[model samples]
Target: MARAVAWRLAAGLIFGISTAASAAAESFDCVIDPAIVVKVGSQVPGLLDSVIINRGDRVTAGEAIATLSSKVESATVALMTVQAGSTSEIEAQRARLDLAQNKLARVEELVKRNISAKSDLDAAIAEAEVVKRELALAEMRKRAAELELNRAQAVLEQKTIRSPITGVVIQRSLSKGEYLDQDKQLATIAQLDPLFVESFLPVSKFGSIKVGMPAMVKPNEPIAGTYEGTVKVVDSVFDAASSTFGVRVELSNAGQKLPAGHRCRVSFDGTTD
Candidate 1:
């Protein structure tokens, strides 16, 4: 009876050891991604004048995307220039001020010689002061108008909209002649170079991952050469429902052959040598 009991105990211990080893070597499949999605939109409201791109069109930075009609902006600038006064008007104002000053001088000389009454001299001084105020007011109004004209010109400049980043147009929302509001979305763009693949692992694997750690990523049918990347991020918190942790890996897509949203295989080092 003692020998039979010993044999049974040894068999149970061996079974438990095998189960732990199998669990330690377990792995999971994950989906990959580009890690970013950029949305493009209009800065101000206007009728969509033109669209230079279509869906899936690749564009470089600073390329013109669309343009609004410039006629309205041009007209506003012209009106402001007129209100700011012309060089000729400024010259005329200066001449009037000089004439007022001469009249005051003549009145002062006559009053001192007893050829004119004190009241006449006082009236001339008051007239000169009034002319001075008028000239100053005119100059102030001219400056205000000049600033307005500058602002209108700046708005006109923005009518030519351009892209800020180099990427492919994934979606186009507005087209020519469509009325757009300031908050309207114009398009969607995605960067093509240096793509990233997104994946998640069980919380048990999170502690072992670190940024800059070497990894091997292969799609189910991967490219000929094994693509390499460094573990870019490991999530700080574990997902309660899924009981998993998020991770990202950055990889170069210089040729853009490896597209976003494609399925890929990922392998990280499980232990130190």
Candidate 2:
């Protein structure tokens, strides 16, 4: 009986040691999280003319993702452009001012030769001044028209929605033929590269984990093997209820060779503060 009891006791000790070793070897559970998520939308209200992209489509920043029915806006821009380029009114006013100046010169010569009355010269001077003022007003109107054209062009550009980031289209909210406004959504986008791995570690191990530390990230599937990860964030505050601090690691996914939002495990081989 004594020998049998000894064997069982040894087995229990080995099991306990193995369990402790496994737990220590594995740090914590991790989730692959996207560092960039964007919701594309039009800045101006209009009829949804067309959606240039579909779900699962890859897009680059500044690329046109969707457009609005902007015929009115386009017409307004063209009209303003023409009006801004037009100087007919200012030219007409300038011609009148030149004529008034010529008349004033003739009147002064006539008065000096005693061929015209002093009142005639005064009348000519007042007429020239009035024409000059009118010419100034016309030039001011031309400048105001040019400013309106600039505003029109800006409004036209706002009718189209552009991708703010290089990412995949996860959803299309506003489709073609629908009316879009500030309250409407256009699409959902998520950047896949440089993915982030989020996890929480016990505060006791906080002394051992540090930002900028190298670690290994193993994804579940469709992305086998280990990818290099760099520790990016270690929360300063601890969760009192769980006694854990959050940690974040970044994984470079250039060319988007791997998928995002997958379950992964991070192993900090020799992480130490």
RMSD of each: 6.9, 5.7
Error of 1 at 105 (Å): 4.6
Candidate 2: regions farther than 4 A off:
1-27, 109-115, 269-273
Clashes of each: 3, 0
RMSD of 1: 6.9
Q: Tell me the TM-score of each prediction against the true structure.
A: 0.68, 0.81
Mind giving the per-residue lDDT tens digits that candidate 1 earns over 161-183?
77777778889988999876777
**For model 2, how does the per-residue alpha-carbon lDDT over 70-166 read when each residue is reduced to its tens digit?**
8988999999999999999999999999999999999999999999999999999999999999999999988999999999988998988899999
Residue 132 miss distance in model 2 (angstroms):
2.1
Top candidate when judged by lDDT against the true structure: 2
User: Against the correct fold, how does model 2 do in TM-score?
Assistant: 0.81
